[model samples]
Target: MSAAVTPAARVERWFFPLLPNSRIAVLRAAIYLFVVVDVLVMVNDVVPKASAPAEFYTPVALARLIHLPAPQENVVLALRAALVIGALVAATNRLPRLLGWPIAVGHLIWVLYGMSYGKVDHDHLALVVALFVLPTVGRSHPHDHRADERAGWALRCIQLAVVATYTLSVWAKIRYGGWDWPSGATLMWAVERRGTFLGEHLVHVPELLVLAQWVTVAAELAAPLVLVLRGRALGLAVGFYLSFHLITYAAISIHFLPLVVCWLAFAPLEKIGQRLETRPVSLRRGHLARRAAAGQAVAVVGHEAVQPVPDPAERRDA
Candidate 1:
């Protein structure tokens, strides 16, 4: 009595599974909050770079295509303020498409302006993709756990972008450093330049660093496996990546926090909102139960006092 699924249907289902809208809501808030912090901390140089000479403003490819101008003091300041305000408003989930679209575009331009000088970071790829895709989901609420294809698609895009970020790193490494990248002194070189106290001590064990390099390359190459992994296997894979990032940061000061934030796409984030909404109700019920127990000696029935029926458990305890 069931309909058969076709190959195209299978592909569509893979790309767009039905996930809770609450996950989208949670992701939106987290991503927006990160944007606020990022503008202030990680990429704060946008306004400052406005003062840098026009000659140093070598626009990136996207900027050139969009005809984005060189950063000006007034323009950059306004863009920064707008970005912060837009992100704050969007986090509130009001007029999502209206605010989110501009925020995405503004963030792109903001990062483009920053990177134009030199040094384009790969970490923002997933985050930028998330910003664009999330808006397509329109409105989602933390308490709304309804399964939505929109939310699933958005999450899937972010997950793919995250996997691509890891997978592409391998490609880039192979392209630039050849097949022997894992056996090379790349990790050692990075440690020498920006290594922390831990990394400094780690340099003494050269073979361990080389082994770590091999593990990292192998892990990144296998990053796509996370998509097909289910249940505990999926959780373990995500944990492994998070642990790798943590260890990387401890060894060197570099932390791809933007990319790390996107990892929530893999989490059952709807539980957080659901628990928060239900906790107060559960507490109120408990409070009433305690009060009832305190006055269990008597009960009022039809405005007449009567002996209360004791619970079997209480009688057993007595």
Candidate 2:
């Protein structure tokens, strides 16, 4: 004897309930970190060279990846700035659902532009994917004190995207490099050949290199299981992924924002906020107390206010 549910009602019922209250806070923190990192990277790009040459702009590379026409100079500049600013705003949770799409799209454009310039770093690929997915989710707003309905959907999307990148990367290595990735010495060879920053140090230890290869395979193969794992299992899996990224950064000097973003996966946002709240209230009150003390009056409990103590010189004069 239940009444039929309307399409709108059904959608809302399914979507809203699945939304995690902590997701907004976690996502907001992630976005803020991302914005700071991105701004630093952009500053590195712009400050090093006042005018980037056409080759450095990488338009053709971008065009191939994004399937868009090569943007003119003015368009490229505008898009780059937009991506940085949009991400900053999005990170702060300002007009999230409304601004997310444009910011995401704009960041993609900026990523493409960078790739087109000359180098397409693999670390950047993960960031491109993260940016692509960020707009689709909801982040918590400090002002509103309410979770956005769409944020729940976005959280699922981000989780899937993280898994997909790992799965696809493994697939790519196998498809392009062949299934012998685990057994063969190809990974070690890659490390030895591309021994830039950390690679140079690792090349001396064959055992470390072998360990790295096996761990990489295991992490990639196990990535899909993250979605099913909950609580501690999920935390361990996320930690493994982070370790993988940390190793990669050390070995190759590659910076992967998605891996950093994936830190949110392990973070118990609610628990973090709860622990933060446990900090001594007196510490915070001390600031206000100091300010009040600076003024001429002191207010005691049950009393409105009392005038400041007169100086010894003033008392002597009186």
Best by TM-score: 1
lDDT of 1 by residue, 1-318 (tens): 999999999999999999999999999999998999888888899888999899899998988999988899999899999999999988888878999999999998888987899988888989999999999999999999999999999999999999999999899989989867789888899999999999999999999999999999999999999999989999999999999999999998889999999999999999999999989877765655565666564433443334445777878999
After superposition, the stretches of candidate 1 with alpha carbons farther than 4 Å from their true spots are: 293-318
Positional deviation of 21 in candidate 1, in angstroms?
0.7
Off by over 4 Å in 2: 1-22, 39-67, 117-139, 142-149, 196-198, 205-208, 272-318
Per-residue lDDT of candidate 2, residues 91-195 (tens digit): 766676677777667666555555565555454444555555555555453323345566555555556667777777778778877757665776468777665
Clashing residue pairs in all predictions, respectively, total 0, 6
Candidate 2 backbone collisions, by pair: 24-140, 57-117, 58-116, 58-117, 137-154, 138-151
Q: Poorest 10 consecutive residues of model 2 by lDDT?
A: 42-51
